[model samples]
Target chain A: MPIHDVNVMILDNDGVLRREGKQLPGVVELYAQLEKRGISNVLLSNNSRVTSDGLVRQMKQFGVKDFCKDQAMTSAEAAASWIRHNPSADRLEDMRVFAVGEEGVFRSLQELGIALANDQWDGQQWSGLPTDVVVGFNTKMDYATTMAPAWNAIHRGSRWIHTNGDVSYRNAAGAMLPANGAQLAYLSTTGKEPAAVVGKPNREMAESALRRMNVTQDQARIAVVGDNLTEDMGLADNLRSAGWNAEGWMVLTGVTTAEDCDDPSVDRVFQDIRQITRALLSR
Target chain B: MPIHDVNVMILDNDGVLRREGKQLPGVVELYAQLEKRGISNVLLSNNSRVTSDGLVRQMKQFGVKDFCKDQAMTSAEAAASWIRHNPSADRLEDMRVFAVGEEGVFRSLQELGIALANDQWDGQQWSGLPTDVVVGFNTKMDYATTMAPAWNAIHRGSRWIHTNGDVSYRNAAGAMLPANGAQLAYLSTTGKEPAAVVGKPNREMAESALRRMNVTQDQARIAVVGDNLTEDMGLADNLRSAGWNAEGWMVLTGVTTAEDCDDPSVDRVFQDIRQITRALLSR
Candidate 1:
């Protein structure tokens, strides 16, 4: 299917719109074209560090107009929704979450009325036991204080959920630094993987993004556009295999280059998000 | 072979003689019996939290007389020695080590004259690059300040070594706490296992213990006595497989009970260290 034929557009935030903290060329134009075509769009990001409000503000700074918080979906938001709506969590009126993350994770959980377990590394009153353990990107986490307790809680039967499984993220210096997946890797040494990972490549975040756009998988020919093939194209492949008419539009703006897009799973390859936008506009 | 035929006896410190900071029954008698039989002994422990000097002092307090620092071997000491004697380390006079550990790790590396990389979690003068990264049991390790740099150094091509692979250790309150192996498990998520592990089940520590005892592996019919099957008996099985006339005498003292000794690797099973001592003295 052509890019213009898609009724819903799911775009990745970091690589597609911005690269290493700067807005990429043609991002604003791409967003404007989507708005002009009346195509429902959701800006999806696996970065659990920033909330949807922060992402909207970031997109506005990039000169993208009319992009509201509702048009944005983050792993943190999806994770919060996943825990709240889960059938297993229905047993409790309020779920006690032992969280290891920054403000985005805390805010998202609070917005959903989930009680945060007050078990911190700082010597103080310890909350009795957590009902669930949620791990995100926490820069202030220490192994002795923060992680030890979380590991103990998980061993003691708390459900474990990680926001995303991206092992490394690019820092301001453009160097890849260890991310949430690295922490999860460390925690998994206790002999169990997380019960759920609410992020890209794992259908939950994609489904949430699609749902937020008021588009059903069957009702729309969706185009998942992003730079990284594993997270972006993998999600498209997964959705297609699940009977959705979805296609992955690989771009050479961030991690993957044109040479790496030879995988048959990628439906189309573009020089960047701008090229895809130009193609759709030309049509 | 009977227990009396063993010329050298290697004992595990915890569970075999002490448990949860308390001395076990017949520990002093067991040491005395080894001394009387003219068997050279070394107390091996995976605890990297304490130095060899500290372990010697602890043994003296437990009423085990004549237990000197030379008769004690820890993962810390083994790790330091492993780095020093390694063929890859021959080029560097003093290797810049990125150490994530406590007093034991520091003291062991200092004693061996290994230079520590100046890179810390706090803003300080950064060391250019580390030749090696060493991890021991650190109670105060946090992700931001300590682990981040270690992770960075490993990605930058530093050889990684861990003290042991035990996931957790019993704290003073008998609660299981994350150990060095747990930290290693976390770090390993970055897609590389440690190049070398210098603790139990690895022949480096056992070889170091044997060297300190002034006995060659060929000169002795060695008996490794411990309560844990994986660490203690596994070490004996490893040595025996490597052509050493070695036996694993499993003691139902700490982690493992009699039911766990059904494995063919375990040569003998005794109720505790006292029972093995009695059987040896009777011969």
Candidate 2:
């Protein structure tokens, strides 16, 4: 509601950081602009399939070369961190995982010592196998590949988990194809919803990201940036739902287009991430 | 994997059925014995909640009536007939007339044809208006409430549609919970995932169910019986993995318990529906 208290700014990828594999104009000046104002910014991307290092490497190819992996938070890393702190979590190393997801998920989980027991897209391939944790950040998912592990793990008292529930994603065909959430929906046919998740809109992600920025609970003033309501804007809604003044900045870029401008939950809509950053700096 | 051919037989409700509130049993007879017959059977549960209608219902209720409404399939009347003709559709009504979900998805859609709107569980709550179509079909769902029209008709374009993604049921606390799916999820979310669905499973549901039933354009005979796959045994996985000698049977007893045993699927497993019925008949 009030703009002055907002200091630490976390940016979204795709639109805010880069478009068409190219950095948006004015990004260089904006960073210089934010630094002059003593503002600390973090780039958080929901693309969990790609590592933070990859984001930094690729954005550098687009001339926003100064981006730091340390200054970034991808959904995958955030999820891993949160799971680590979970009081009674299963050991990350020992869990039999059925990863129906992209490269980022596999690499990050591996880095965290979470073994990938299966690499099939649909959960069907993993059925009858002894899988415990079923991670869904998949991009190349089909019907059979998604539901099998979910049905098996959930029935066996294993953990039913997801990286995020971002449903449809803008495909190469420009049509939004099914994302993790859609795959999860397919698994819903198994009639088992997720037992837990570590992704956007969940309090754990917000808490961990803020803590990483060294912003204490009381000292923290957070703002979630994204495009969709059920996911991006939902992040802010979830925060507010939990009594935080978290506001959502919806860019008419990806996911929810300008056609969906009337979505009531969207606190504020912007042309793109560039505009959002410009406004924050102006404030 | 190649799809396998199998024969399936389903049972009708009201006669060989018995129920209590909304739990199903007697399905075991349908599944287990049939499994021994080298025929795989999946109970087509219309219950939208869990994977299958477990055995607790029929055993306790004494028949198949205690089925969850959302999990059961369409009767000879209601939207069942509609789906028989227009199998590939996403909406049920296109005019603003009248409707709700509790009474019946069909009657509510019929009201829409004449241009009278009403408050249905999955329908809109009309206020002041002679608007388009109205749909209704929710139990204990109030009608004649003026606000109903405004929300259903006035809010969006007229052509009202009634999808039975109804998500209302008594929870463990004995308090009503929201279910059926998109509509109820929207009702609970208020401006989240819009309410736009029709019939059961829409096209996706039909195709998947048909696949599970082991019926194809090839040499295959498939019969689907059950109280409801939507609410019961909706996740019944007797026929998945693209194909492998599968057949499906949705039982009206105890959800999908042993009732599927006699189902003509490649293999059938139920709490013992056929055995119970045969037992009852012999007795």
Candidate 3:
């Protein structure tokens, strides 16, 4: 699909618009051009710590002032959205989630009217076992306090849901640290794999974005632009497989370097989002 | 090999002799029969928290008062022993280990004259990176304090050594909890598998026992008795493959029930260690 024919755009936050908490070049112009061309755009973030409102605020810091909550979707929020639409969900309020994550997971589930089962230990066992287990990234996770109870709940038949599948991420000091996927990998050693991973490369997150934008796959031409080849570009592949006209555009501002842009998942490669903006606005 | 011809015995502590911290039936007689028959015996434990001295104390409580540190081999101790005998080791005093485990791992490595690197963060990075990273089971392991530094160290080319690979273990309350294998699984998601897993079903621990017994594989007939199939019986199979006259004897007192005992790994099955004692003593 051509950039001019893209009626909807899914932009990855970390590398596409900003890197290391600083806005990259052309983020402002990119949003301005997208709005002028009447294209619905969503900022998709795999960082499960941030809510949609938090994402909007972060985008505002990145010179994306026009980005609103409706244009933002965090993995935590996508997990919550997926839960709300689960076929087993008879009453939204009746589902209790044992969240093994930070604030975004709790807040997103709370916003969806899903009750949270207490994750704290009572010295003997969990305060309460939950019906569902929602895992996200949390640096403070301990075995006795968080993982044990979550393991017990999952073995006892809790519906396991993962916000993302990123096994490692770069920290502030450029060191690779264990992420949510590591925790998921830990729990799934002898247990079940997560029922769904509502992050990039998984269709659930993109489906949530589609639902929020009020567009069906057949009715829209989608473009996924980001720096991560497996995450952003792989998402475009998933969308195209699901009957959407989606193209993946890779940028070199974050993880992917110029030498690493030969992946078939990427439809095209750009030096930065500035090049992407120029390409989209040329016609 | 027949029971009477066995000159060396490897007993798994968990199911063969005790369950949930209490000694099982015929433990005293089992030791007495082995002593009378002049059989060399070593109590092998996968628990990484206990030192050899602690294991001796544990066995004494289980009605075997003669059990000593030399007759016990902990996975933690085996890991330390393996490190001491590593082919790359030139100066034993110069090796610094970043240990992600409980007291046994620390004490074992320290006893072997291996220096410990500080795993604590200085609000910026690890206090010091290490040449080797040894992971064991720690219910208190948190990402920011333990796993993140460990992940960074491993990615930075630290020699990764795992104490054991039991992913889940039955806690005091009989509920399964995350164990060292789960930690190993977590770290190994996008990283290299440990350079060695110094636990059951691996030849390193058995070789350590053989070294301690001062017997060559061809010079002795060995029998490994345990309740778990993969760890204990599989160890017998491993030793056999390594040219030892070894046989796996399954006892129905631990993780394996009678219904689960039809595997080809076992040369014989007993109701418990009591039956083995009776059979060996009768002939």
Candidate 4:
């Protein structure tokens, strides 16, 4: 079915607009075209390694002048907002978060008033320090290093949380290898799962993005466009399944391909956002 | 890339072939066809839940008729052989084995003439009573259950041995979930891994299966087929990575699918053994 839509488009940042830290061929041109038509578009992405401020700055380096930091929303900021709103949750200050993660995760906890501790071990004698929340998203972690805190936490009734359940990451070598989330799973000693995950495919981030856009599910008339089924297309599919006025739109550039477009979960497929924007304009 | 010459086939009995006492589709039919092809196919599975004889009998109900007692070797049997063959290892006839598994595992020890004790309250309580090796697989397992004999054995410097490191089982809903291997990993809580693990993906199982076939690696051609990339493909890829003559084959009916075929480790893709056998014959 043709998506008869207006007003909102959720654009993926990495592949649709940028490639290898640089803007792609049609990114600037497409954005200018969208701006000329006065269509509402926001760069909604799952990457948490960088803050939205950092993303906006990087996008500016590519001759894109129209976009600003407020327009770019990342999963980390949404995670902080999620924690803030969930009042019955484990108090951020009281909980000891064992963060085996990146700078963005650190910044997220700081915003939530959640205290975090990274590798103090650094060859020090290992101690049974209680980690109240064992957050998974660490790149430089090993079995013992990751387990030391989780072992303390689960036994102590501390919660476990994963950043996102992304199983693999792309490298300079062009190999899609096991990501930190899967590695965290291997080191989980107590068979406990993350108390909460605040990333793509999770409703927290999507709901936060929609709220920030100042549009209700019925009034927004939104379309989610991305590459992966589980993370991207599945997000919209899940929203639709849950009775949201949203539909999954997929692209073939990254994690999911043109082949996965055939899956019934996906509402529409596009070669790129430029084509999608044009199609939406006609609709 | 197209593959050539499938001389040997290894099968996973659980989930991939038979799941929770029920045989999956085309299992017996595939078995009869492979048996007619004269392929050196062995069921190299990781189901320590039952003994090899019991498993063979279960397979019989599913229409498998060629399995003999000797041919249906369990990891326990391999562990027994390893102990008997090692000069530094405990002598089978004179040894005391503390078992943490079912009747089949204990029966193997009893039939092999190893001493058995009803160890309770830490094998240490029965310490002076004679304990040689502590064997772990799966019983109606509990913390108190393992702690007693396990602690006693660990304290006495009694050797530790485990069957396979399979972390989970498939649910009735077809979800691949975690299993007892996570508990065995906790035996490190008592300090030390089993002296050896015996089944698929383990070099010992590969070596033993190859030894029983009486063929050198160069002379032996092998194709390993399974549904799980982590377990089945892991078995094949691990063998090949260790320089064994094996090609990692994938079947969609079990765990992985053609959708995730972009993964580099999958060497051959087949719907089932029937198609693979037909292709082999034609080739």
Candidate 5:
């Protein structure tokens, strides 16, 4: 229940560690304290556009040079891991995916030996039929070429899976931009909910992260610290409801403001990752 | 309320007159009977892609050689008409619109002496900031280039308007394709409803059609005949609710079936336009 008692910490990327392309204060120290306490941590991010490798590089830029790919889990990676574990076909290699995302999504699926349908986004081109229509955060997806085909495929009975549920993401200028949830809403006009939304607040991504960390949800003392209440704190709430010893730690470093910290989802609140590091170091 | 007493008829294009690009039986004879009786008819279509010119051409193809531009009203035309009457600024020319649609939408807006913002759909190219963001049926809309910018504009204080609410449209192959409603849903993740949906079963298009036909809603004996329940019969319901002498006439030629005609929205049911023609002639 205390900061030191937390055996594993699941930290959000955009707000808790780095923000606006810069490493936030105290993330390096928080990592160091977790290492000193012999506590495991997963840099869990709902950003489906980045791979574990991309996350590790970001961690290195944040002064955590020791952060490895094993310590990082992106929604894209979680999607691949989830798909690999829950195979739609008899064989893993036989599974065809029509993925709408960047390199992270493509790489993760490829690592699991999943064949991608219509990989290229070049003008009105298509490959084999997709068994699964996987939607991630596609910043450059076109409706006629990419989405219409995906919609058609889904209508024709392909299983739909979204990477996350965040409809809008804040840009550097503090402007809201369309995210995967918005993309999901476009397809949701079909009146079918996705088979899986493998991201934050969902059990799939957390389960995958816990498995990767060699920790069981029911036994491990987990703490999910995030700036977004619905995603980060909500993830903690989900874990607790699932019978895990998890707490949702809110940080006022991103979207969540001081006024929003009083929510039931927030078990604990910190000004930023620096305050969290101070709390951990003091204990 | 008798069939012979109907002075003006509002017919849906897709289901009532034709289906999948071919003319349905009884439409020609029905037009003949209506012309002989001096009863006015307006071809009301929720499809924003086609202009009045296109509808006239389609009518000619359907063997109704006398059908003119004045007898047709598309959602695109309705949108322009709605905007012209309800201008965002003091003058219509001063109000800029970022329209997401085909040539029909462009032509309609242009004809109303309204300025268009970002007319071209070329990649990442933008002309100007929009005061109004109008969404119509665009089969070729892209996310990064078109929708994202529109989403950004809406968030930054732009009035949003959708031409129609039908999410999907049946293609020539009988497969449902993404329509403007799907595009509207995509933008709806902003948590804001459109300022106006200038299509049926909304009152804007129907009212515009009434004006075009020189018939006031309160006095004119109106019959709305279409195959779909929600858009067609629903228009009649809306009209009647607004104190109009309007009857919903259901046709069995389109999306609606024989069993669906039992709903409260249906005032009368016929096999097709031919059956309606027979009833009219007999009367």
Candidate 6:
């Protein structure tokens, strides 16, 4: 199905709206098209380095003045939200999380009033066992200092939760920098995957975005628009599997190219987000 | 087939001869039996934390008066030796090694006259690209401070070498501590195995020890004694594959129990090193 009939839009950041700090051509027009068509839009990013509010500020700088903080959902925020609504929410104050990431992860958890486990060692072991180990994208993490404590904590029975599973990200110079999943791979070598992943391809993030749009899965047609097939297209497939009428729109702007969209998950291919936006608004 | 006719003994340190800073029962007698029988012996340890000289001092403190540094081999020394004998040895003077390890690794490379690569980042990248990245046992390494440089260097085409592949090691309290291989697993997430591993199960270390014993593989009936099947028994199997008449003697004093010696690679099972030594000299 074409995205022209969809009333709700789920968009990926980084590659779709912008590439390496500069807004991609037609981003401003894409938002205008969404508004004119009365289609609710949510910006979803697997990047947990920046908070949703920070992303909104970034979007405003990129000339998307209509995008508000409420319209953005980060994996970090989704993870904290998941924890807050889970069965453990009854004793949220008592739950201790050992977090491994930068600003987005720390700030999101802090805002939710979740207690962070002490990382300092008391000569023998960690100060205390954590209730959960949350990992995000951390560029300054040290293996012996940061990872060792987390590894030992998990071995001692802490639940492992990861914000996203992006193996690599494209830097400004187009170099592939190791991402959150690469570090998670180090932790997973101890023989277990993370207990929960709240980013793209996971229904939790899509559901969180859909809830923000105030649209039920059965009430509207949804289209996920982005560049990478594994993340954006995978999310569309996951939502469709969960009974949502979702379609994937692949754009050739960052990381992926035209030849890479030969997958059944991708329902349409565009030169950029501008072309997709025009197609979605044409009907 | 029995060790009674074997003239060369390859022994694992730690578990067989000693346990937790103290010599195991009959360790001194076991060494005396080898000396009296005029059999050549080499103490091999996958531990890259201590140098061979340091191991000699440790053995001397445990009552092995005749033990010399030349009779000991650590993965650290073996790695350095491997670097010296390979085709890369021709440019030893021009080669710079980026070492991610402790005193044993640093000291061994320094003693071998190999220039150490500068790990200090000059804001953009490493001061200079390393010719080889040697990873050993390092407990104090952090991901950002230590591993980032190693990861970046490897991505830039530096040869990756590892001292050993032991995933976990038993600490003094018998608790398992993540070893060098565990850290290496983090670096390996970038999709490449190490170019060389100089420890157990690799024929290079065994060849280095055989060179020290002044014996050719065909000239001696060799018996490897250890409690771990993966390292010691695997080393015996490796040597046999390389045309040596090597036998594995599984001792029940350390990591492996008697019931675990059902593998065909384990030619004989002894209660301890003392019992194995007696069997080797019975003849």
- What DockQ does each listed candidate score? 0.56, 0.04, 0.72, 0.02, 0.53, 0.42
Query: Candidate 6's residue-wise lDDT over A1-283, tens digit each?
Result: 6566889889898888889877789988888888988988898999998999998898888787877888899999999888777734357887988888989999999998998885554434666678888899888776445676677777667788899988777555444456787777777766767788899989898898788778986677988988888888999999988899999988888778888889999888889977876676674
* Residues forming the 10-long window of minimal summed lDDT in candidate 6 chain A: A118-127
Which one wins by TM-score: 1 or 4?
1
lDDT of 3 by residue, B1-283 (tens): 6678999999998877888777789999999999999999998889898888988888788778888888989899999988888923468766778898999999999888888776345544666667788998898888877888888788777889999998777877777777888898888875687999999989789889889889896688999988888899989999989898999999998999887888889899999888998899783
lDDT (Cα, 0-100) at B53 in candidate 6: 92
Which runs in model 5 stand beyond 4 Å of their true positions?
A119-129, A217-219, B119-129
- Among the numbered candidates, top TM-score falls to 3
Error of 1 at B196 (Å): 1.0
Fnat of model 3, as a fraction? 0.71
lDDT for A249 in candidate 5 is: 91
CA RMSD per model (angstroms): 2.2, 15.9, 1.7, 20.4, 2.7, 3.0
- In the predicted model 5, the residue pairs found to clash are none
Error of model 1, residue B130, in angstroms: 0.9
Which clashing pairs does model 3 show?
none
The candidate, 2 or 6, that scores higher on lDDT is 6
What tens-digit string does per-residue lDDT give for candidate 1 at A181-278? 87787778667678889988888888877776678756889898888888889889988888889999888888888889899878999888778778
Alpha carbon deviation, residue B88, candidate 4 (Å): 30
TM-score of candidate 1 to 2 decimals:
0.95
* Count of clashes, each model: 3, 132, 0, 13, 0, 4
Model 1 chain B: which ten-residue window has the lowest total lDDT?
B118-127
Q: What is candidate 3's lDDT per residue for A1-283, written digit by digit as tens?
A: 5668889989898877877767778888888889889999898999998888988888788787777889999999999888888934577766778888888999998888888776344544655567789999988888877888888878778899999998877767767788888898888975687899999989889887888789986688888889998889989999988898899989999988988888898888999988877988795
Worst 10 residues of 4 chain B by lDDT: B120-129
Better of 2 and 5 by TM-score: 5
Q: What is the interface RMSD of each candidate, in Å?
A: 3.0, 13.6, 1.4, 16.8, 3.1, 2.8
User: Native contacts retained by model 6, as a fraction?
Assistant: 0.31
Q: Alpha carbon lDDT of residue B30, candidate 4?
A: 68
